[model samples]
Target: MLTLSLILLPIIAGLITLAVKGETAKTVAVVSAFAELALGAYLYSSFVPDATSQFSVSYDWIHSAGIKFSVGVDGISLILVFLTTLMVPFIILSTFGNNYKNASTLFALILFMQAALVGVFTAKDAFLFYFFFEAALIPVYFIAAIWGGENRIKVTFKFFVYTIFGSLFMLLALVYLYLLTPGTHTADISALYQAARVLDVETQSYLFGAFFIAFAIKMPLFPFHTWQPDTYEEAPTAGTMLLSGIMLKMGVYGLIRFVLPIVPLGVDKWGFVAIILSVTGIVYGSIIAIQQKDMKRLIAYSSFAHVGLMSAGIFSRNIDGIQGALIQMLAHGINVVGLFFIVEIIQQRTQSRELSRLGGITQSTPNLTVYFIILMLGSVALPLTNGFVGEFLLLKGVYEYNVWIGAVAGLTIILGAVYMLRMVQKSMFGVTSGITEGFADLTFNEKIVLFPLSFLVIALGVAPNIFLKVTEPAVSQLLSIIK
Candidate 1:
């Protein structure tokens, strides 16, 4: 029931939002988002810190095809569930300062996307996971295409094409696995794992490629990352938050859930290739971010870089590596969303995302400056900030895997500090520019949005164990399975 409510609340509220008008829709969305958060809190309270799935519920969906509507929570899924529920209200609230056209539909789509994200995280059936996986794209695609900037149509089309193209590979992989199941041919998560385990190393390697392609494109890991910056730049801030903060996690989640244990031999064979690509992306994205004059686009590349480390850590396939990836997912989601909102606030006030055109915001908006610096420090992995523990563990894991790659991967920290602080120096300091001379501080509503995020940055940093304890058992279990 807890799992069901987590998925259903957003869905039901989305339907309600569609029928409401004007401010009512926003009200409904905010209420719904908070309600989801409450459920997430209860879920955390109820969930035991162990590897076993809890609150599981399954119903026959396609009886003839052997698919069931199965959903549950474990430590790994719970953290992400928490992230989705925790972030949605803030994402919605962040938009309060603007008056978008057809506001009802926009909020409705956010709620719907939330529902799909929850579904993806909790799903325990292979086909059900795939169903929710693809279902999530619809609302976000509409969110970006309809409400985004001047080039939204072109940029979103490429995004749509890249994701849909990648998803086909995932579907193909799932379908192939389904046929390999014994007896009744179920697509249960465990059954898929069992079937996959019997395959030859060569076959598993092929499966690895199929699954990796789908997830890589979603994480938009290096070579596959072309669509990301443009889409982030063109999408509405809410849409960008959803994409960067929550939606992209689906890919990382898929890598951990579907790829690792199910295809261990495959991973052993081809995982190094993934590690190389991910490390390359780390350096590649950070360098590109340093060159970006547009704040949103810069953060987009930053996100791309951060996810590369997460991917590399997971592929490292050690306890530290995978555990680090899990905690980092939560930290990255929080920090990135806050960063994008900071960008949104600046853009909203100054009508520009260009670093060259903005300056001296700190003179007027001390509160905004403080929050921005906190989130920025978190992004650069300052000690005792949210980003620190995860990156440390990730680098440790990568080092255990290979010294040279770990050395290269560590560049993200230095490069991140350079670009992010540069952004701060150029945008927040210096003499007030003509455009930013009268820039105002955070509005009451904007404060409401950023305050929690700012608090979380320090809190997660100070006591990451609150989160790490829950995921450790699950990570151990996964490592055992893969081994």
Candidate 2:
């Protein structure tokens, strides 16, 4: 019942928002998002970490085809679910000052995306997971295309084509896996996992290739990442947040759910290649980010870098690696959204994101500078901040897998600090430029969005156990299956 409501509320609210008039749409969306967050918190409180799945509900949807309307959450699912619910209200709140054209429709699309994200995280069946997986792209497509920058049409097209291309492979792989189910064909994920365990090595390799491509494109790891920065630059801030904060996690989560357990042999065989690509992305993205003059695009490349590390952690296939991935997912989502919102704030006030056209912002806006520094520190993985715990654990995990790769990957901290602090120096600390002379402090709504995120960066860094405990059992279960 809880899972059903969590999935339905955003969808229901989105519909109602479409019919709403004037400012009521934003209010309705915000209120509904808050309600969903409360429900998620309650679910977390009641969740038994040792349990396999909680709030599970399934119904016969296609009797002959063996596909069921199945959805549930375990410890692993809960963390991603928590990230979804946790980020949404703030995503909505961040936009309160901007009067986007057809604002109701924009909010509605965002909420719709939310519902699909929750569904993706909670789905317990392969087809159901894929359904939500593809379903999520639709509203985001509309959001980016309809409400985005001028080149939005072009960027959105690329994003759609690239993602849909990967999704087709996912659908194909799901069908292949489903047919191999014992007795009557079924799409139950657990059953699929059991069946996948016994699959021949060659078949597992094929499945691995299929699953990895889909997730890789979503994670946009390395060479597959071309679509990301352009999409982030062209789309509206809210849309970018959706993409970075929760949408990308779908791919990382899929790796945990599908590729790791179901195709362990294939993972063992091809995992090194995946790690190489991920590490390459981390380096590639960080280098590109350093050269970016556009604030938003810089953050976009930074996201590519951060996600690359998370992917590398997944392939490391050690307890520390997996747990670090889990912790980092939450941390990354919060920090990236904060960075994007800061970009939005700068653009809104100065009417420019050009690093060269911006300067000495800290001289006027103490509040914004403080928040920016905090988020920046978190991104660079400073000690006693949220980013530190995850990056440390992730580095330790990668080190366990192969010291040379870990050594290469650990360069993220140095490179991250270089680009981020340099960005701050040019944008916030130097002499005021003509464009930034009118810079103002964050608005009430902006503070509402940023302060809480800043708080989480510290709280989670200081005591990661709150998030780590929930994922331990699920990670344990996954390792058992992989073994």
Candidate 3:
């Protein structure tokens, strides 16, 4: 019932929001989002920090097709569920500063997207997971395409085509796994895992390729990442938050949930190639970010770099690697959303996002500067901050996998500091530019959004155990399956 409510509440709220008009719709959306967050908090509190799936509910959906509506949360799912619920309100609140043309419709789509995201995180059936997986894209599509920048149509078209193309392969892979199940075939995840493990090495390798393509594109990793920077730049900030904060995790989670355990042999065979690509992306994204003058595009490339590390950590396939990925997913979502919000604030006040055109914002907007620096430090993985714990563990895991790759990947920290601090120096610290001469400080509404995110950046850093302890058991159980 708890699991089901988390999925249904946002959907119900979205419908109600659609019926309402004007400012009321956004108010309704925010209240409903908080309600959903409260429910998520309860679910987390009641949850046992162990390997078992909790709050499970299953019912027949398509018996002939061997599919059922199955949903639940283990520790792994809970962490993501926590991230989704925790971020939505801030994502919504961050938008309170701007008024869109069709405000009601925009808020409604965000709520709908949240529902699908919860569904994606909690699904216990393989087909259900894929269903939510693709379903999550629709509202965000409309959000980006409808309310985004002038080039939105062209950019979003490519974004839509790329993700849909990759998802087809995942659907094919899931269908193949479904047919291979034993008598009374089912798409139940546990059953699929059992069935997939028995396939010949070559067959599993093919499945691995199919699944990896789908997730990699969603993660928009390296070569597949061409769509991301443009999409993030063109999309509205809220849409960008959905893409960076919660949506990309769908891919990383897919790699952990579907790719790792189901096709261990294939991973053993081709995993090295995946690691190489991920590491390459880390360097490539950071370098590109360093050269970006546009604030949004710079952060877009920074996100690409951060996710590349998360992908590499997952492929490392150690407890430390996977755990780092898990915790880092949460940390990255918070930090990136904060960073994008800062960009939005700057653009809103100074009417500019280019670092060269802006300066000395900190001289006036001291509060904004502080929040930006905190989130920035977290991104660069400064010690005793959230990013540090995850990056340290990720480095440890990658090192265990191979010292050379780990050594190359370590450049993320140095490069991240370079690009991030440089961004701060140029945008917030130096002499006031003509455009930023009288930049305003953070609004009360803006503080409501940044303060909590800033708190999490430090909170998670100091005591990551709050998350690590919960995920450790489920991660151990997953590694056992792969072994």
Note the Cα lDDT for every prediction shown. 0.94, 0.92, 0.95
What C-alpha RMSD separates each model from the true structure?
Answer: 0.7, 0.8, 0.6
| Candidate 3 RMSD to the real structure | 0.6
- lDDT, candidate 1, equals 0.94
List ranges where model 1 is wrong by over 4 Å.
none
My TM-score estimates for the predictions, one after another, are 0.99, 0.99, 0.99
Per-residue lDDT tens digits of candidate 3, residues 278-363?
99999999999999999999999999999999999999999999999999999999999999999999999888899999988889
* Tens-digit lDDT track of model 1 for 206-280: 899999999999998989999999999999999999999999999999999999989999999999999999999
lDDT of 2 by residue, 205-250 (tens): 9999999999999988989999999999999999999999999999
Q: How far is candidate 2 from the true structure (C-alpha RMSD, Å)?
A: 0.8
